[model samples]
Target: MELSPSAHVDTFCRDRLPPFDLWPQLHFDLPELRYPERLNCAAALLDDAVARWGADRPCLLTPTDSWTYGDLLRRANQVARVLTEDFAVRPGNRVLLRGPNNPWLVAAWFGVMKAGCVAVTTMPLLRAVELAQLCEISLPAVAVCDHRYLEELQVADAPDMRIVAYGGGAPDDLAARCAAKEATFQNVDTAADDVALIGFTSGTTGRPKATLHFHRDVLANADTFSRHVLKPRPDDVFTGTPPLAFTFGLGGLVVFPLHAGAASLLLEQATPDQLADHVADHGVTVLFTAPTAYRAIMAAGKADRLAKLRRCASAGEALPAQVWEDFRTATGLRIIDGIGATEMLHVFISAADDDIRPGSTGRPVPGYRARVVDEAGEPVPDGEPGLLAVTGPTGCRYLDDPRQETYVKEGWNITGDTYVRDADGYFWYVARSDDMIVSSGYNIAGPEVEKALVVHPHVEDCAVVGVPDERRGMIVKAYVVLKPGLTGGVTTVKELQDHVKRTIAPYKYPRAIEFVADLPRTSNGKLQRAELRSRAVGAAG
Candidate 1:
């Protein structure tokens, strides 16, 4: 599918053209893009789906019930009316949504968009402190939460935010209120460039950064990944484990499926076992999940249930060659691994069926350009490891964050990932640029060590980080999670360290090892190396 010259400009305008025509020229330019523009994602995508696919087609499928395209539209409209008439939610208001992945959460997201309020979806695992911090940063006017997790949002320090509880049989009260409310609400006149959502990064290191996306960005993933990568059929059913708050989940579980007029199975609790069951029960054709979950499901011997899935996508971390091979051997389907960030909106690099290589993240998708660059921002030769830089339809646009200068350099969003492009143009994953460990002046990628450790029979999960040392400057430290029933002590640690020494470079072996029941992970399931690094520094001190 070759995009015409005007196609680029037309798609840009259509995707981003806000209701009020704010910052019209900014939409066309690159670096000069700014916020406070008019935008509403519900109008652009969900409403379009209702128009084309009609309301009778299944749009949201869960363990409890299924919602057709029309049902979702009506519920979202009812939600919009409830927010506007009852809760007093208005344009430019920031509304925080706290809940597990379910049909209500999806409805609330579109309703928030329909009401012209920015949606701030958070991970359900966050406690009061994390929730309070996000509320402080966003200063949200209202919060819609699942009654099951309401206690987590009841932090005393949170600024007087209004709360509306969903589920838990509030049906008699809230349902009556929803029925009395108007089912049709007009879209607020918003510019296509206005901030539609404030997606907070999983703060593995320091404070989480809120990456801003406009209405156009919500659909950009569909045009890029849905069109090029998965190519879902209208009859395909989609499901995943990533939280809807994370762009990874939102793209695969919500946007891609909705855009293609397919059904999505949204689970409040998506364990590997639950995922396998859903695929079998709902005939889910497309699966989106992390590499860790894939490994876990393979270990659990549930690969047979996933055979019905036609397309599978892996992200949130590197996909190990062994995991890829094991999944394919069991399910007879190649898992397409891609690398995406909140900044880029969705996966910028991925492989379709025929283009996949076991260990390599395929070349950049259409409408995007990716290259490896050196310290000075010069392109590195093919087969040389360097920082990955990307420029395309959807790039990093932070919300008045100082880190913008660091991430968006020279019109390209320089993802923190380090990679090497082979002569064949396949991009191989290295460690995060900040995660590169320097031991005795040798730069070793932590992912390489972690991948080696995962292949061990006794190791279930592991994270490799650098600890400060006086002599070596920084020494490799490994925090490992043993498989169930495996003992963790000096003997096992030594054996795992020896295993790493044999797998890759001898010097990359962990000088220090700690065994735990579980390793820290971000909301999206990425390893929290920054947290591990902090612990390592504290231990060294």
Candidate 2:
């Protein structure tokens, strides 16, 4: 699909450009580089916004409460003092924050930064086993959890971790201690290179790896992507469905809005219908969510309620062409789809309004360079598919993991995604390199099959994966969720399989189908193909 030109988005693209020197050994000094010896995200981003925008402006909004810029700053400082004087949280200390998306989570996140501690945010839905694994790896000193999810943090084996509960009856003892303390707190003296947060990747293919980001790296994303790609206005309100624990959601819903002096509409429950209601009620201008949510909103015929939105961004997975087309037809808005990872901090490649190419993930954003490389790290031809290698202001810094060598080679961060760059520099996403199914000497991407099924009227959600087969070595298997009125049966499965054959290459059609009520998704709304593959293997066994 082609995108028409827009003055606002087009101006942003024109002002940002790639580095002049493109050789393998050449490096160019960038004028936008502003790195201080000491850095604190709370001071550099949030405090600066409050000072420039004034105290009256709303900084964060939840269903039940709203905090002004000054209010948020004061509360963050209060939490910072409590963490430092009472809990002994200091530099290099890791603190775990597990809760639903709310104003308290934002306050605690900034407070952790102000106290010069590393904030390791985990999903609220994580079970004891997952929580234990994260605790073992991160070795957090303190845990601040919402009262609703306190049971999940009650692991029998978590060693010497302090638990602070919020949203319950704020214990008088704890409240008294906090109330007595002064709200004025100084920013911790931290270097720009000091690690601020440890974001764990959603391990759909392997064990989850922790990706560390420095203080400057955090703000760099706001400068590059938020300034160049999102361009959120100060009066705009932002809302999204991604959990704040995920870096994609953290940047889009929290950091970007704070950096831009805009307010974020936070929701404890982020269903599609609820999100639409919030957008209409709050006059939210910018919306960040996944492709599935967009499809659901269109399916529900509620796109008209989003008339207040000025920009819509999709991430966490590839955006299907059909979803994009449907949204444009319904709302006359082009959904900006970008590919990002926890390792990259934020989106490195994206399309602005003028340069959008449907079925493509757009060109590299400013301050970042992307290349498709062969197995030996050599650049491939423009049209040939290869592993996507990216280098920019923010890159992966894993936590004591040997896999760092595999992901970050030399200076470039090697994303496991396979992509093809066209002659015009538009990057087309293929699939995860490891997820490419090789069957009878043919390469098949699971997303291709899933996209085909989504275009069909009966399919709601689906996950495609490769299952072990003696005859073909690996066979395509699709785990599908049908629409609300559609019934899953043998005849429907055969018809869907035939639909896939007609949509794409015949060999890529699903050999087997399992209709289910829902697909297993991560807290960030990414499809967990690994879980589906495991289920298939277990069934075969």
Which residue pairs collide, candidate 1? Answer: 16-192, 18-191, 18-192, 19-190, 37-194, 38-190, 38-191, 55-70
What tens-digit string does per-residue lDDT give for candidate 2 at 1-541? 1112211211211122122121112122245547766778889777888789998899899877889988888878888888888888767688899998998888889998888788899999899888888888788888988888989798725878888887777663233445677878888777776678889889644567877777877888888888888898888899999899999889998999988889999887777877888899888999999998999888787899999999999998999888888899999999999999898889989996878988899998887899999988999999999999998887766676667768766567889999999999999999988779888889999999999998888988988999999988899999989989889889998899999999999999999999999998876678888788889999988
Residue 201 lDDT in model 2?
88
Name model 2 segments beyond 4 Å from true: 1-30, 172-177, 204-207
RMSD of 2: 7.8
lDDT of each: 0.81, 0.83
TM-score of 1: 0.91
